[model samples]
Target: MYVGLVGCGLVGNKRARGLGSNHRLAAVADKDLTRAESLASQHSGCDYFADWQAVVGHPACEVIIVATTNDTLAEVATAAIDRNRPVLIEKPAARNSKEIEPLIEIAERNGVPVKVGFNHRFHPALIQARQIWDTGELGDLMYIRGRYGHGGRLGYEKEWRADPRIAGGGELLDQGVHLIDLSRWFAGEFADVDGYVNTYFWRMPVEDNAFMLLKTIAQQVAWLHVSCTEWKNLFSFEIFGRNGKLQIDGLGGSYGTERLTYYQMSPEMGPPATVISEYPESDDSWEMEFAYFIDCIQHGCEPQGNLKDAKAALRIVEALYEKHTSGKSVRL
Candidate 1:
């Protein structure tokens, strides 16, 4: 399938390499001509353009990938779907659903489908976690906990991510969106969600740290703590169940870098059961996610990370934003 790229920034470049494979990089565009050319030149037959509309409008490009900032994701996605092209937009979908919901409505009106990129669900470790849950190996889940963030924008005054208007926020929207989605995925739909966020350490406009409390539909509670100010850490998720607990220690790539371990009670009754661990050596979340989208496009199947999932995840963000600003609990 021929694909077009809208941005050549860090995530765009990384996905261009990882998602490139045998798929056609028919066209590419970026606000920066230099960056577009640099990335386009890496693969043959990839046309370059300065304006994103040009890339998405190219007749030869069958699919469009929107990797621009949160500000332009909705605009790019809406236009692409209008042209009857399927699209894969990077996370958060938009700064808020206000910016993206219309695109969802537009796609629905046109009978077209666009996918929001939530690559975490495609991770090997997450895949195993889901399998364990389905198999009842971990029994009924009790709680879900996660931590995901970085110190990439530590001292930036002019970074787009530091600006709430551009990035939405630091911990919650920027990185915590992944954990928020993961929390819902592991613990089921949230019965209630309430949280706190703060701006600290860095002199940025958005909150850099956040903590959330959630209860699943069954009243099983979970905690999601995320921070963008942490200088040297990564992402991880732990699931507590009736029988034991499962923890996944790596969120290194679009695919993960760890295994699923079960800490069950030992037969001796006084000690813990043997901790049995299972590892799926392959970590190709990027490839796996893109392949799933390809399948969705090819089979006319609804996407796993479709626009609907994107909206559901962003709803939590909206609630968090309302709560943070209003200093009152907001219902989802």
Candidate 2:
């Protein structure tokens, strides 16, 4: 498959490398032509474009990947879908649910598949945890706890992420949506949401921290907190069930090693049985996620992380943002 990628930044580079051997970059685009050219130079026969629209319209592109800023995600994906091309859009998909709503409608109407980049779900530890959950080893799921954060660098406030108009809602929309999506994947639709967002350290207009409590109809809860104020980078997610518990820590790289610990309850209680598994390999979540997207494209099925999931996560984010802005709790 030939992929047309828009956004030749950090994520764009990851996407290109994650394309696997079966797919090749057919066209690459970025507002900065030099960036596009740089990426295009690395991939043989790949063309460079200054306008994303050209990549979307490129005759050789069978699939499109939109790795642009939050505000342009939906716009670029929509254009690709309009061309009857499948699209892989980076997470949050859009600035808000409102922005994603129309894209969903258009994609559905066009019968074009769109995959949202929720790559965290493909982490090795999480994948192993899902298998454990499926085996009933954890029994009935009770709740999920997730905390993910990173310390910002110098001049971080001057980046596009600090601009609400470009990055949407800050840390919540950034790393927070991954936690929200994972929660929904395990606990089902949330019936209630209670949370707040705040700007603790960064001077940006958006909040640097977000705290959330999401509950399913069965009372299964997801307590999540995402931040950019943490002096040390971290990622921790734990799932508690009636019979056992699963704890996942780190995400490789600066977040430390990736590991999962399973604690199975003893028949008589007391300490319980424990098993630990660690993944010391470099992060392959991006490649695995792109592979799933490719599978969806080949099998004529919708992606696991589609626009609907993106919209659901965005709604949770918007709810918290609303609560913080209006000084009131949002019921939904």
User: Which candidate comes out best when scored by lDDT?
Assistant: 2
The superposed Cα distance between candidate 2 and the true structure at residue 184, in angstroms, equals 0.6
lDDT string, candidate 1, 190-270, tens digits: 757788999888777788898888776678877888886677666778888877677777665432456666677544646
Candidate 2's displacement at residue 243, Å, is: 0.5
- What's every prediction's RMSD, in angstroms? 2.4, 0.9
Q: Which residue pairs show backbone clashes in model 1?
A: 265-273, 266-272, 266-273
Error of 2 at 43 (Å): 0.4
lDDT values of the candidates? Answer: 0.80, 0.93
Model 2 CA deviation exceeding 4 Å by range:
none
Q: For residues 131-186, what per-residue lDDT tens digits would candidate 2 score against the true structure?
A: 99989878899999999999999999999999999998799999999999999888
